[model samples]
Target: MKNVLHYKGYSAKPEYSAEDQVFYGKILGIDDLVDFYTENAKELEQEFHAAVDDYLAFCQEVGKQPQKEFSGTFNVRISPELHRKAFRKAQEDGIALNKVVENALTEYLSPAWHENRTVILPEEMAKMYSAEEQTVDTAPDDASHLALWKRNWTVVNGRTEMKKRC
Candidate 1:
Protein backbone atom coordinates (compact mmCIF):
# COMPACT_ATOMS: atom_id res chain seq x y z
CA MET A 1 0.00 0.00 0.00
CA LYS A 2 1.08 3.54 -0.69
CA ASN A 3 1.46 5.89 2.26
CA VAL A 4 1.89 8.99 0.13
CA LEU A 5 -0.71 10.86 -1.90
CA HIS A 6 0.01 12.51 -5.25
CA TYR A 7 -1.90 15.44 -6.76
CA LYS A 8 -1.07 17.90 -9.48
CA GLY A 9 2.67 17.26 -9.27
CA TYR A 10 2.68 17.58 -5.51
CA SER A 11 3.02 14.77 -2.98
CA ALA A 12 2.07 14.46 0.69
CA LYS A 13 2.84 11.75 3.21
CA PRO A 14 -0.23 11.05 5.28
CA GLU A 15 -0.02 9.25 8.58
CA TYR A 16 -2.67 8.10 10.98
CA SER A 17 -2.78 9.46 14.51
CA ALA A 18 -4.39 7.06 16.93
CA GLU A 19 -4.34 9.54 19.77
CA ASP A 20 -6.07 12.27 17.80
CA GLN A 21 -8.24 9.84 15.80
CA VAL A 22 -7.32 11.63 12.63
CA PHE A 23 -5.06 11.50 9.63
CA TYR A 24 -2.50 14.26 9.20
CA GLY A 25 0.04 15.04 6.51
CA LYS A 26 2.33 17.76 5.27
CA ILE A 27 3.30 18.83 1.81
CA LEU A 28 6.53 17.16 0.69
CA GLY A 29 9.50 18.91 -0.95
CA ILE A 30 8.17 22.36 -0.20
CA ASP A 31 10.04 25.34 1.17
CA ASP A 32 7.19 26.26 3.53
CA LEU A 33 5.47 24.01 6.02
CA VAL A 34 1.94 23.09 4.87
CA ASP A 35 -0.09 20.66 6.91
CA PHE A 36 -3.57 19.16 6.64
CA TYR A 37 -5.72 16.94 8.83
CA THR A 38 -8.89 14.92 8.49
CA GLU A 39 -10.78 12.61 10.83
CA ASN A 40 -12.29 10.49 8.09
CA ALA A 41 -10.19 7.97 6.22
CA LYS A 42 -12.28 8.44 3.10
CA GLU A 43 -11.55 12.16 3.13
CA LEU A 44 -7.83 11.77 3.82
CA GLU A 45 -6.84 11.85 0.15
CA GLN A 46 -9.23 14.69 -0.57
CA GLU A 47 -7.73 16.62 2.33
CA PHE A 48 -4.25 16.03 0.92
CA HIS A 49 -5.27 17.21 -2.56
CA ALA A 50 -6.97 20.27 -1.12
CA ALA A 51 -3.89 21.02 0.93
CA VAL A 52 -1.66 20.81 -2.14
CA ASP A 53 -3.98 23.06 -4.16
CA ASP A 54 -4.13 25.57 -1.35
CA TYR A 55 -0.38 25.53 -1.03
CA LEU A 56 0.02 26.25 -4.73
CA ALA A 57 -2.60 28.97 -4.64
CA PHE A 58 -0.91 30.55 -1.66
CA CYS A 59 2.43 30.42 -3.42
CA GLN A 60 0.98 32.09 -6.49
CA GLU A 61 -0.71 34.77 -4.42
CA VAL A 62 2.56 35.52 -2.66
CA GLY A 63 4.49 35.50 -5.99
CA LYS A 64 6.60 32.59 -4.76
CA GLN A 65 7.74 29.54 -6.64
CA PRO A 66 6.50 26.18 -5.44
CA GLN A 67 9.25 23.70 -4.69
CA LYS A 68 9.55 20.73 -6.99
CA GLU A 69 9.00 17.26 -5.64
CA PHE A 70 12.49 15.92 -6.33
CA SER A 71 15.75 17.75 -7.00
CA GLY A 72 17.71 14.60 -8.00
CA THR A 73 20.06 15.09 -5.09
CA PHE A 74 19.91 13.64 -1.59
CA ASN A 75 22.19 12.42 1.14
CA VAL A 76 22.55 8.76 2.06
CA ARG A 77 24.40 7.07 4.86
CA ILE A 78 26.36 3.85 4.45
CA SER A 79 28.95 1.89 6.36
CA PRO A 80 32.58 2.79 5.79
CA GLU A 81 33.30 -0.61 4.30
CA LEU A 82 30.46 -0.30 1.80
CA HIS A 83 31.48 3.26 1.01
CA ARG A 84 35.01 2.14 0.30
CA LYS A 85 33.83 -0.74 -1.88
CA ALA A 86 31.54 1.51 -3.90
CA PHE A 87 34.25 4.10 -4.34
CA ARG A 88 36.68 1.46 -5.51
CA LYS A 89 34.11 0.10 -7.96
CA ALA A 90 33.42 3.57 -9.34
CA GLN A 91 37.13 4.19 -9.83
CA GLU A 92 37.55 0.88 -11.60
CA ASP A 93 34.60 1.63 -13.88
CA GLY A 94 35.91 5.19 -14.60
CA ILE A 95 32.75 6.75 -13.19
CA ALA A 96 31.74 8.87 -10.25
CA LEU A 97 30.36 7.41 -7.00
CA ASN A 98 27.11 9.28 -7.61
CA LYS A 99 26.75 7.53 -10.96
CA VAL A 100 27.23 4.20 -9.30
CA VAL A 101 24.51 4.97 -6.78
CA GLU A 102 22.19 6.28 -9.49
CA ASN A 103 22.68 3.20 -11.66
CA ALA A 104 21.97 0.94 -8.68
CA LEU A 105 18.81 2.83 -7.86
CA THR A 106 17.63 2.81 -11.48
CA GLU A 107 18.18 -0.94 -11.79
CA TYR A 108 16.36 -1.50 -8.50
CA LEU A 109 13.38 0.62 -9.54
CA SER A 110 13.14 -0.64 -13.12
CA PRO A 111 10.18 -2.96 -13.74
CA ALA A 112 11.99 -4.67 -16.61
CA TRP A 113 14.70 -5.78 -14.21
CA HIS A 114 12.11 -7.56 -12.06
CA GLU A 115 10.17 -8.97 -14.97
CA ASN A 116 13.20 -10.37 -16.79
CA ARG A 117 14.93 -11.75 -13.73
CA THR A 118 14.38 -15.17 -12.20
CA VAL A 119 15.71 -15.92 -8.73
CA ILE A 120 16.16 -19.41 -7.35
CA LEU A 121 16.92 -19.47 -3.69
CA PRO A 122 19.32 -22.10 -2.43
CA GLU A 123 16.62 -23.83 -0.37
CA GLU A 124 14.25 -23.81 -3.32
CA MET A 125 16.93 -25.12 -5.66
CA ALA A 126 17.72 -27.86 -3.19
CA LYS A 127 14.07 -28.86 -3.05
CA MET A 128 13.77 -28.84 -6.87
CA TYR A 129 16.96 -30.81 -7.57
CA SER A 130 19.34 -32.54 -5.20
CA ALA A 131 23.09 -32.19 -5.71
CA GLU A 132 23.33 -35.86 -6.63
CA GLU A 133 20.57 -35.43 -9.19
CA GLN A 134 22.33 -32.62 -11.02
CA THR A 135 23.64 -33.98 -14.35
CA VAL A 136 25.63 -32.45 -17.22
CA ASP A 137 22.41 -32.09 -19.19
CA THR A 138 20.65 -30.24 -16.40
CA ALA A 139 23.46 -27.71 -16.01
CA PRO A 140 24.59 -25.79 -19.05
CA ASP A 141 28.28 -25.39 -19.78
CA ASP A 142 27.97 -21.85 -21.15
CA ALA A 143 30.27 -19.41 -19.36
CA SER A 144 27.99 -16.44 -20.04
CA HIS A 145 25.06 -18.09 -18.31
CA LEU A 146 27.26 -19.06 -15.37
CA ALA A 147 28.49 -15.45 -15.10
CA LEU A 148 24.93 -14.16 -15.20
CA TRP A 149 23.89 -16.56 -12.46
CA LYS A 150 26.87 -15.50 -10.37
CA ARG A 151 25.98 -11.85 -10.81
CA ASN A 152 22.34 -12.45 -9.93
CA TRP A 153 22.65 -14.76 -6.95
CA THR A 154 25.07 -14.97 -4.04
CA VAL A 155 25.27 -17.21 -1.03
CA VAL A 156 26.88 -15.74 2.06
CA ASN A 157 27.46 -17.81 5.18
CA GLY A 158 25.22 -20.54 3.84
CA ARG A 159 22.31 -18.09 3.43
CA THR A 160 21.10 -17.04 0.02
CA GLU A 161 20.44 -13.35 -0.50
CA MET A 162 18.01 -11.90 -3.00
CA LYS A 163 18.13 -8.26 -3.96
CA LYS A 164 14.87 -6.32 -4.02
CA ARG A 165 14.04 -5.07 -7.49
CA CYS A 166 10.52 -3.87 -8.05
Candidate 2:
Protein backbone atom coordinates (compact mmCIF):
# COMPACT_ATOMS: atom_id res chain seq x y z
CA MET A 1 0.00 0.00 0.00
CA LYS A 2 1.05 3.59 -0.59
CA ASN A 3 0.09 6.73 1.27
CA VAL A 4 0.08 10.35 0.05
CA LEU A 5 0.79 13.40 2.17
CA HIS A 6 0.04 16.96 1.14
CA TYR A 7 1.68 20.12 2.45
CA LYS A 8 1.72 23.67 1.07
CA GLY A 9 -0.28 22.46 -1.99
CA TYR A 10 2.39 19.89 -2.88
CA SER A 11 1.78 16.16 -2.59
CA ALA A 12 4.34 13.47 -1.77
CA LYS A 13 3.53 9.75 -2.25
CA PRO A 14 5.36 7.22 -0.13
CA GLU A 15 5.12 3.51 -0.96
CA TYR A 16 4.93 1.07 1.90
CA SER A 17 3.80 -2.00 -0.09
CA ALA A 18 6.09 -5.05 0.00
CA GLU A 19 7.15 -4.98 -3.70
CA ASP A 20 7.33 -1.17 -4.00
CA GLN A 21 8.97 -1.00 -0.57
CA VAL A 22 11.70 -3.32 -1.83
CA PHE A 23 12.43 -0.76 -4.55
CA TYR A 24 11.93 2.48 -2.61
CA GLY A 25 12.80 1.29 0.90
CA LYS A 26 15.77 -0.97 0.13
CA ILE A 27 17.24 0.30 -3.14
CA LEU A 28 16.50 4.04 -3.14
CA GLY A 29 17.48 4.93 0.45
CA ILE A 30 13.86 5.62 1.47
CA ASP A 31 14.44 3.67 4.72
CA ASP A 32 16.75 6.43 5.92
CA LEU A 33 14.08 8.89 4.86
CA VAL A 34 11.54 6.96 6.92
CA ASP A 35 13.94 6.87 9.90
CA PHE A 36 14.44 10.64 9.61
CA TYR A 37 10.67 11.12 9.36
CA THR A 38 10.11 9.03 12.47
CA GLU A 39 12.89 10.63 14.50
CA ASN A 40 12.40 14.33 13.67
CA ALA A 41 8.85 14.43 12.32
CA LYS A 42 7.47 16.60 15.13
CA GLU A 43 10.40 19.03 15.12
CA LEU A 44 10.33 19.32 11.32
CA GLU A 45 6.59 19.92 11.42
CA GLN A 46 7.09 22.65 14.05
CA GLU A 47 9.75 24.29 11.92
CA PHE A 48 7.37 24.39 8.96
CA HIS A 49 4.63 25.92 11.14
CA ALA A 50 7.06 28.54 12.50
CA ALA A 51 8.20 29.41 8.95
CA VAL A 52 4.58 29.79 7.84
CA ASP A 53 3.81 32.00 10.85
CA ASP A 54 6.81 34.20 10.13
CA TYR A 55 5.84 34.52 6.47
CA LEU A 56 2.22 35.43 7.35
CA ALA A 57 3.41 37.99 9.90
CA PHE A 58 5.72 39.52 7.29
CA CYS A 59 2.88 39.75 4.78
CA GLN A 60 0.63 41.41 7.35
CA GLU A 61 3.30 43.91 8.31
CA VAL A 62 3.95 44.89 4.69
CA GLY A 63 0.21 45.09 3.76
CA LYS A 64 0.68 44.32 0.06
CA GLN A 65 2.14 40.96 -1.03
CA PRO A 66 2.82 38.81 -4.03
CA GLN A 67 2.76 35.03 -4.37
CA LYS A 68 6.10 33.83 -2.92
CA GLU A 69 8.61 32.89 -5.57
CA PHE A 70 12.26 32.06 -5.82
CA SER A 71 14.39 34.51 -7.81
CA GLY A 72 17.92 35.55 -8.74
CA THR A 73 21.26 33.87 -9.04
CA PHE A 74 24.74 35.08 -8.12
CA ASN A 75 28.05 33.75 -9.39
CA VAL A 76 31.74 34.41 -8.79
CA ARG A 77 35.19 32.96 -9.44
CA ILE A 78 38.30 32.97 -7.25
CA SER A 79 41.65 31.25 -6.92
CA PRO A 80 41.35 27.76 -5.34
CA GLU A 81 43.40 28.79 -2.28
CA LEU A 82 41.29 31.92 -1.74
CA HIS A 83 38.12 29.91 -2.24
CA ARG A 84 39.18 27.41 0.39
CA LYS A 85 40.06 30.20 2.86
CA ALA A 86 36.73 31.94 2.23
CA PHE A 87 34.83 28.66 2.62
CA ARG A 88 36.53 28.04 5.96
CA LYS A 89 35.77 31.55 7.17
CA ALA A 90 32.12 31.23 6.08
CA GLN A 91 31.83 27.92 7.94
CA GLU A 92 33.21 29.56 11.10
CA ASP A 93 30.75 32.45 10.78
CA GLY A 94 27.78 30.18 9.85
CA ILE A 95 27.08 32.11 6.63
CA ALA A 96 27.24 31.29 2.92
CA LEU A 97 30.63 31.79 1.24
CA ASN A 98 28.82 33.98 -1.29
CA LYS A 99 27.83 36.42 1.49
CA VAL A 100 31.45 36.78 2.59
CA VAL A 101 32.50 37.40 -0.99
CA GLU A 102 29.67 39.93 -1.50
CA ASN A 103 30.63 41.84 1.67
CA ALA A 104 34.32 41.89 0.64
CA LEU A 105 33.60 43.11 -2.91
CA THR A 106 31.10 45.73 -1.63
CA GLU A 107 33.67 47.17 0.77
CA TYR A 108 36.50 47.03 -1.78
CA LEU A 109 34.47 48.85 -4.45
CA SER A 110 33.07 51.55 -2.08
CA PRO A 111 33.60 55.30 -2.66
CA ALA A 112 36.17 55.42 0.19
CA TRP A 113 38.89 55.46 -2.49
CA HIS A 114 37.50 58.73 -3.95
CA GLU A 115 38.90 62.09 -2.84
CA ASN A 116 37.78 65.73 -3.35
CA ARG A 117 40.21 68.08 -5.07
CA THR A 118 40.55 71.86 -4.39
CA VAL A 119 41.51 72.92 -7.92
CA ILE A 120 41.18 71.59 -11.48
CA LEU A 121 42.66 73.40 -14.49
CA PRO A 122 41.20 73.61 -17.99
CA GLU A 123 42.83 71.67 -20.86
CA GLU A 124 44.04 74.84 -22.69
CA MET A 125 47.32 74.93 -20.69
CA ALA A 126 48.73 71.92 -22.58
CA LYS A 127 47.94 73.41 -26.02
CA MET A 128 49.26 76.90 -25.08
CA TYR A 129 52.69 75.58 -23.98
CA SER A 130 53.48 73.21 -26.83
CA ALA A 131 57.25 72.70 -27.44
CA GLU A 132 57.15 75.68 -29.87
CA GLU A 133 56.53 78.14 -27.02
CA GLN A 134 60.04 78.27 -25.52
CA THR A 135 60.96 82.01 -25.76
CA VAL A 136 62.03 82.67 -22.10
CA ASP A 137 64.50 79.69 -21.70
CA THR A 138 63.02 79.24 -18.16
CA ALA A 139 59.75 81.09 -17.92
CA PRO A 140 59.23 78.96 -14.80
CA ASP A 141 59.40 75.48 -16.51
CA ASP A 142 56.13 73.61 -17.15
CA ALA A 143 52.85 74.12 -15.22
CA SER A 144 54.89 74.05 -11.95
CA HIS A 145 54.63 77.88 -12.14
CA LEU A 146 50.82 77.68 -11.64
CA ALA A 147 51.27 75.84 -8.32
CA LEU A 148 54.04 78.28 -7.28
CA TRP A 149 51.78 81.21 -8.11
CA LYS A 150 48.97 79.73 -6.00
CA ARG A 151 51.33 79.34 -3.01
CA ASN A 152 52.64 82.92 -3.43
CA TRP A 153 49.08 84.22 -3.65
CA THR A 154 48.21 82.47 -0.37
CA VAL A 155 51.32 83.97 1.38
CA VAL A 156 50.51 87.48 0.05
CA ASN A 157 46.86 87.16 1.06
CA GLY A 158 47.78 86.06 4.62
CA ARG A 159 50.03 89.17 5.22
CA THR A 160 47.43 91.99 5.60
CA GLU A 161 49.88 94.17 7.71
CA MET A 162 52.64 93.68 5.06
CA LYS A 163 50.17 94.84 2.39
CA LYS A 164 49.58 98.11 4.39
CA ARG A 165 53.41 98.61 4.75
CA CYS A 166 53.86 98.12 1.03
Candidate 3:
Protein backbone atom coordinates (compact mmCIF):
# COMPACT_ATOMS: atom_id res chain seq x y z
CA MET A 1 0.00 0.00 0.00
CA LYS A 2 1.15 3.52 -0.74
CA ASN A 3 1.36 5.65 2.40
CA VAL A 4 1.55 9.45 2.55
CA LEU A 5 2.40 11.65 5.52
CA HIS A 6 1.95 15.41 5.90
CA TYR A 7 3.87 17.55 8.36
CA LYS A 8 4.40 21.30 8.58
CA GLY A 9 2.77 21.73 5.16
CA TYR A 10 5.11 19.24 3.45
CA SER A 11 4.00 15.92 2.00
CA ALA A 12 5.98 12.66 2.02
CA LYS A 13 5.15 9.54 0.03
CA PRO A 14 6.31 6.24 1.52
CA GLU A 15 7.09 3.00 -0.25
CA TYR A 16 7.76 -0.38 1.35
CA SER A 17 10.79 -2.42 0.47
CA ALA A 18 10.22 -6.13 1.07
CA GLU A 19 13.96 -6.91 1.03
CA ASP A 20 14.79 -4.15 3.53
CA GLN A 21 11.63 -4.81 5.60
CA VAL A 22 11.17 -1.05 6.07
CA PHE A 23 8.95 1.75 4.76
CA TYR A 24 10.94 4.58 3.22
CA GLY A 25 9.61 7.96 2.19
CA LYS A 26 10.85 11.12 0.51
CA ILE A 27 9.50 14.64 0.40
CA LEU A 28 7.93 15.08 -3.03
CA GLY A 29 8.03 18.58 -4.53
CA ILE A 30 10.96 20.75 -3.41
CA ASP A 31 14.39 20.40 -4.99
CA ASP A 32 15.95 19.33 -1.68
CA LEU A 33 16.08 15.58 -1.03
CA VAL A 34 14.69 14.40 2.33
CA ASP A 35 14.23 10.73 3.16
CA PHE A 36 12.86 8.87 6.19
CA TYR A 37 12.28 5.22 7.03
CA THR A 38 10.40 3.11 9.58
CA GLU A 39 8.51 -0.16 9.93
CA ASN A 40 5.45 1.32 11.64
CA ALA A 41 3.06 4.08 10.60
CA LYS A 42 3.36 5.97 13.91
CA GLU A 43 7.13 5.85 13.77
CA LEU A 44 7.00 6.85 10.12
CA GLU A 45 4.93 9.89 10.99
CA GLN A 46 7.47 11.01 13.62
CA GLU A 47 10.34 10.39 11.20
CA PHE A 48 8.56 12.28 8.42
CA HIS A 49 8.22 15.35 10.64
CA ALA A 50 11.76 14.96 11.87
CA ALA A 51 13.02 14.79 8.28
CA VAL A 52 11.21 18.03 7.44
CA ASP A 53 12.60 19.73 10.53
CA ASP A 54 16.06 18.46 9.70
CA TYR A 55 15.80 19.76 6.16
CA LEU A 56 14.83 23.19 7.43
CA ALA A 57 17.59 23.15 10.04
CA PHE A 58 20.15 22.05 7.50
CA CYS A 59 19.13 24.90 5.18
CA GLN A 60 19.32 27.36 8.07
CA GLU A 61 22.78 26.13 9.10
CA VAL A 62 24.04 26.32 5.51
CA GLY A 63 22.43 29.77 4.92
CA LYS A 64 20.58 28.41 1.88
CA GLN A 65 17.02 29.51 1.20
CA PRO A 66 14.45 26.70 1.22
CA GLN A 67 13.24 25.76 -2.23
CA LYS A 68 9.60 26.49 -2.95
CA GLU A 69 7.45 23.95 -4.80
CA PHE A 70 6.37 26.34 -7.54
CA SER A 71 7.62 29.72 -8.87
CA GLY A 72 4.25 30.72 -10.54
CA THR A 73 5.93 30.79 -13.95
CA PHE A 74 6.93 27.97 -16.26
CA ASN A 75 7.43 27.23 -19.93
CA VAL A 76 4.62 25.46 -21.76
CA ARG A 77 5.11 23.85 -25.18
CA ILE A 78 2.27 24.15 -27.69
CA SER A 79 1.87 24.05 -31.42
CA PRO A 80 2.59 27.32 -33.21
CA GLU A 81 -0.93 27.39 -34.63
CA LEU A 82 -2.50 27.03 -31.17
CA HIS A 83 -0.16 29.72 -29.80
CA ARG A 84 -1.16 32.15 -32.56
CA LYS A 85 -4.87 31.37 -31.99
CA ALA A 86 -4.57 32.03 -28.27
CA PHE A 87 -2.83 35.35 -28.94
CA ARG A 88 -5.50 36.32 -31.48
CA LYS A 89 -8.32 35.42 -29.06
CA ALA A 90 -6.66 37.49 -26.34
CA GLN A 91 -6.39 40.44 -28.74
CA GLU A 92 -10.06 40.16 -29.73
CA ASP A 93 -11.08 40.01 -26.04
CA GLY A 94 -8.84 43.05 -25.29
CA ILE A 95 -7.03 41.15 -22.50
CA ALA A 96 -3.45 40.11 -22.01
CA LEU A 97 -2.55 36.66 -23.29
CA ASN A 98 -1.00 35.84 -19.94
CA LYS A 99 -4.34 36.47 -18.20
CA VAL A 100 -6.17 34.34 -20.75
CA VAL A 101 -3.70 31.50 -20.29
CA GLU A 102 -3.81 31.80 -16.51
CA ASN A 103 -7.60 31.77 -16.41
CA ALA A 104 -7.81 28.78 -18.75
CA LEU A 105 -5.22 26.86 -16.75
CA THR A 106 -6.97 27.63 -13.46
CA GLU A 107 -10.35 26.54 -14.81
CA TYR A 108 -8.90 23.34 -16.26
CA LEU A 109 -7.01 22.40 -13.09
CA SER A 110 -9.78 23.34 -10.64
CA PRO A 111 -13.25 22.28 -11.73
CA ALA A 112 -14.99 24.00 -8.79
CA TRP A 113 -13.24 27.37 -9.21
CA HIS A 114 -16.51 29.07 -10.19
CA GLU A 115 -18.54 27.34 -7.45
CA ASN A 116 -19.11 28.96 -4.02
CA ARG A 117 -17.09 27.27 -1.29
CA THR A 118 -19.20 28.17 1.75
CA VAL A 119 -22.92 27.37 2.06
CA ILE A 120 -23.89 29.90 4.75
CA LEU A 121 -22.80 33.47 5.40
CA PRO A 122 -20.43 34.20 8.28
CA GLU A 123 -21.94 35.08 11.67
CA GLU A 124 -19.95 38.33 11.85
CA MET A 125 -21.86 39.67 8.82
CA ALA A 126 -25.36 38.81 10.17
CA LYS A 127 -26.03 42.51 10.83
CA MET A 128 -25.87 43.24 7.08
CA TYR A 129 -28.66 40.77 6.33
CA SER A 130 -30.81 42.06 9.21
CA ALA A 131 -31.30 45.37 7.39
CA GLU A 132 -34.03 45.89 4.74
CA GLU A 133 -33.35 43.03 2.33
CA GLN A 134 -33.04 43.78 -1.38
CA THR A 135 -33.42 40.99 -3.90
CA VAL A 136 -31.65 40.88 -7.27
CA ASP A 137 -32.27 38.52 -10.15
CA THR A 138 -30.01 35.50 -9.85
CA ALA A 139 -28.06 34.10 -12.77
CA PRO A 140 -29.15 31.03 -14.69
CA ASP A 141 -28.54 27.53 -13.26
CA ASP A 142 -26.14 26.62 -16.05
CA ALA A 143 -24.28 29.93 -16.03
CA SER A 144 -22.98 29.44 -19.62
CA HIS A 145 -26.19 31.04 -20.90
CA LEU A 146 -26.00 34.45 -22.56
CA ALA A 147 -27.93 36.03 -19.67
CA LEU A 148 -24.72 36.07 -17.66
CA TRP A 149 -22.64 37.13 -20.68
CA LYS A 150 -22.49 40.92 -21.17
CA ARG A 151 -23.38 41.58 -24.83
CA ASN A 152 -24.57 44.65 -26.80
CA TRP A 153 -27.94 44.06 -25.10
CA THR A 154 -28.92 42.90 -21.60
CA VAL A 155 -32.12 42.06 -19.74
CA VAL A 156 -32.70 44.86 -17.18
CA ASN A 157 -35.72 45.17 -14.89
CA GLY A 158 -37.57 42.35 -16.67
CA ARG A 159 -37.15 44.08 -20.02
CA THR A 160 -34.63 43.54 -22.82
CA GLU A 161 -32.62 46.77 -23.25
CA MET A 162 -29.74 47.90 -25.38
CA LYS A 163 -26.54 48.46 -23.38
CA LYS A 164 -23.33 50.29 -24.26
CA ARG A 165 -20.80 47.74 -25.48
CA CYS A 166 -18.02 47.49 -23.03
| lDDT of predicted model 2 | 0.41
Candidate 3 lDDT, 42-149, residue by residue in tens: 688888889999998998999987666576888888789989999999999999988988998888589574443323444554434443443324444446654653
Compared to the true structure, candidate 1 yields what TM-score? 0.66
Clashing pairs in 1: none
Give the whole-model CA lDDT for all candidates, comma-separated. Answer: 0.73, 0.41, 0.70
If scored against the real structure, what TM-score would every candidate get?
0.66, 0.25, 0.51
lDDT tens digits, residues 1-166, model 1? 6677898877888888999999999988777899999999999998988888888888899998888556789998978998999999899999999999999899879877545344445675545543432222222255564433323233443344444322
CA RMSD of each candidate after superposition: 10.3, 26.3, 13.8
CA lDDT of 67 in candidate 3? 62
Question: Candidate 3: which stretches are off by over 4 Å?
Answer: 1-4, 18-21, 69-71, 79-85, 105-166
How do all the candidates rank in terms of lDDT, highest first?
Answer: 1, 3, 2
